[model samples]
Structures are given as C-alpha cells and as structure tokens.
Target: MKENENKNEIVEIDDVDREIINLFNEDGRMSYRKIAKLLNVSIGTVHNRMEKLTKNGVIQKFTPVIDHSKLGYNLTTIIGVRVKGGVLENWEDRTAYHKNVLCMYDVTGEFDAILVARFKDTSELDQFIKSLLREPDVQRTYTQTVLNIVKEDLSSSKML
Candidate 1:
C-alpha cells in the first residue's frame, strides 16, 4: 500500500497493478486489451484495475513525454529565488501559471523556491528573470542555463 500525500489515502496496489502501470509508463496509448494479453489477464481485469487506480489517485493523468528542444524551446534553466518574508506562497501562486515554468518546488536552502523553466531564447529568459526581479516580494534570483540533458524521465512508474 502506498499513501497518496495529496488525499491522505492509502492506495493498495498489487503486482498486477504495478505491471499495468509499467506498461502504461512505457506507452501511454497502449490499449487495455493489449495490456491484458501481455500480462496474461482478462481485458476486464485491466479495465477494472485501471479504474480503481485512477479513482484512488494512483494514476493521475496520462500525458506525453515531450522534448522541449524539438518545439523551439531551446533553453532550459534552473532558477533559485529568494522571496520576502511571509510572501513565498503568494509569489509561488502568482508564478505557477506561467507557460514557461515546467516545475517549481518549495525548497530548503538559501532560496525559498526553485523553478525549472524553458525559453525559446536568451531574450525570453532575460525578460522572465527581469519580470521576477520586478516583483516586490522577489528579493533575488540565481539562474543557470543547462548545456546538456543527460536524462529526463518524469515518470514514477519506473521506480516501481
């Protein structure tokens, strides 16, 4: 059983559930029939398990793994930001909806939050950093450009 942090619910996942998840992680478009065949189970079992997994919040949503560079988002950056006292959440809420922000975290260190964002070019990145600086609560920001991506997999199913 795994605990869902968001819902505070215990999700019971058996070996079959793990296998189904692994197959979907490899290919999200895989059909229930195919998964059933591969796992040597009935198609109904696959459907029921998927439904239970989704209902339990074990499977959030199926999405494609995109290569941002192929889509002209040529620059990837990791930025650490320091916010004014008591306004970290406010700043996070304001910034979370930005199209360029891929992921954000409330972290422990010198910085209050960290953001991973992608930009089309340096000009866009410059504009974004300047915009953050313009915010009253944003005390400072440190940006680092990524030169190469060794590996990027945003799937937890691999760990299972």
Candidate 2:
C-alpha cells in the first residue's frame, strides 16, 4: 500500500454511504431493508450502492469466523519467517494450499513474512514448519504459541 493511495483516488460519498457501511461492518448479515429503513432511503438505493461498492472492490468478501477449538484444532501459533528468492512476493501460491495457515503477510520487521496458523497437534505443526524450511527460498523462522486471542477484526473497519 502506498501512502499516496487515497490522495490519488477520489471517493466522495454522502452521509448515508458512511452509515450503511458502518452498520454492515458491525454485522454483514443485516438485511438491505433494515439498512434502507435506518438510512431513510429506498431499498433499491441501498441495493445499488452496495452493489457498486462490491463491484469496485471496496467490499472484498463476506465470510464467517469459526471456533476452531470445537473442530479439535486447539493450537494457535504466530511464525516469523525470513525467506529468499522473492518467495515473499509469491506467498499467495505458497500458502494457498495450506488449510491450516489462516493468514500470511510480507511485513516490515525482523522477519520477511509472518504467518498465523491453527493445527490439530504439534506433530502436524512440526511437519508444516519442516516443509516450509525445505523451501529453497526460506532461510529461517521463529515462532511462538498463542495462548490467548484478544481481538479479531475481519472487516477491516478502516474501509468501512
């Protein structure tokens, strides 16, 4: 993301757009009729604006959050990975096939990549990490088990 991204793009919206996004950010399953009533707009208008927003990539995807513990995946971990050969750039392909890898990031810090993962047990986690180490692009990794989940923000409120 560039610092000049918003400066280069123009996004002009009335108060209704802001309110609708806020309401939807709070709950994605809210009905369009409810949104229209709250904003005092027609259902058609709400539908059109939401459609435009979705098409323009303002709203990426609607998804659910799950309790993995119930599924027997009780371990959570954050890994800091340093890699080579531009693997950081192709992380989408690198991690896409991994179901337990929840998220990957090319971040600015002590590491080149960061990954959050959930696993059924330590052996599975060890195998995953071992394979990651075998990648010619990957050099080293550091990881820590997560004992608590303080907050989870899926909607990215700034966009709303």
Candidate 3:
C-alpha cells in the first residue's frame, strides 16, 4: 500500500492496475476495448479497473501534453523564489494560480520555491515577476530564461 499525501490515506495499486496505468501513460486516447484485447481481459474488466483507479485518485485526469512554444508562449523561464519563513505555503498558494505559471515546486537550497512559467515575451515575464515581488511575503527572486528545451516529458511511465 502507498500513502496518498493529498488524501492522507493508504492506496494500493496491483500489478494489473500498474499495467493499465502504463498503457494509458503511453497513449491517453487508448480505448477500453483495445486495452481489454491487449490485456486479454473483458472490456468490462478494463472499464471497472480504470473506474476504480480514478475513484481511488490514482488517476487524476487525462490530459494532453501540449507544446507551449507552438501556442505562442515562447518564453519559458524558471523563477527561484525566496519567501519569508513560516509563510512559504501561503506564498506558494498565492503564486501558483497565475495563468502563466505552468508548474511550481517547494524546493530546497537557496530558494524556498521554484516556478516554471511561460510567457509570450520578456515584457510579459517582467510584469509577472514584478507583481510577485510586490507581495509582502516574497523576499527575493532569481529568474533564468530557457534558451531551448532539450527534453520535456511530463509522463513518468515512458521508462516502463
């Protein structure tokens, strides 16, 4: 059994569940009938397993991996933030909801949090960073613009 930190409960995924998850990770558009045929199980079985996995919160949502650069969000930058201690969570909750923020992480070392965000250009990024710094809880920030993305794989099952 594995603990779900968000739910604060025990959740166990069996071998079949792992296999189904791997298949979905490979191709989110894979149908239950195809999965059943591949696994030599009934379509009903595949459906039930997937339903269970979703209900148990193992599967959050099925979404596509998009290329942000192609969508005119060409500026990808990593912003490291230093926040006032004891208010790290509060500050993270505030910064994470910005539309340009693609991902945020509570990290270690010199920064308390890291934000991966996308913008159309440098001016937009500058405005966003300035707004973040204006927050009383935010102490400082270091921004590094991405020159090029060599590899970006959001799905974790490619190794499987």
Off by over 4 Å in 3: 1-10
Candidate maximizing lDDT: 1
Task: State the lDDT of candidate 1 residue by residue for 1-160, as single tens digits.
Answer: 4454558666778899999999999899999999999999999999999999997888989888988889999999999999999989988999998999999999999999999999999999999999999999999999999999888887857766
* Lowest lDDT 10-residue stretch of candidate 1: 1-10
Distance (Å) between predicted and true CA of 129, model 1? 0.1
Return the candidate ranking by TM-score, descending.
1, 3, 2
For candidate 3, write residues 1-160 as lDDT tens digits: 5545558666787777888999988899999999888988899989999999888887889999888889899999999999999999888777789999999998889999999999999999999999988999999999999998998887786443
Off by over 4 Å in 1: 1-6
Candidate achieving higher lDDT, 2 or 3: 3
The 0-to-1 C-alpha lDDT of every candidate, in the order given, reads 0.93, 0.81, 0.89
Question: Tell me, what's the RMSD of every candidate?
Answer: 2.7, 3.8, 2.9
What TM-score does each of the candidates earn? 0.93, 0.81, 0.86
Count of backbone clashes for each model?
0, 0, 0
lDDT-better candidate, 1 vs 3: 1
lDDT of 2 by residue, 1-160 (tens): 6545645465666677788788888788999999999899999999999987776556667876678899999999999988875567775476746999888887897898789999999998998899888888888889899988888675656664
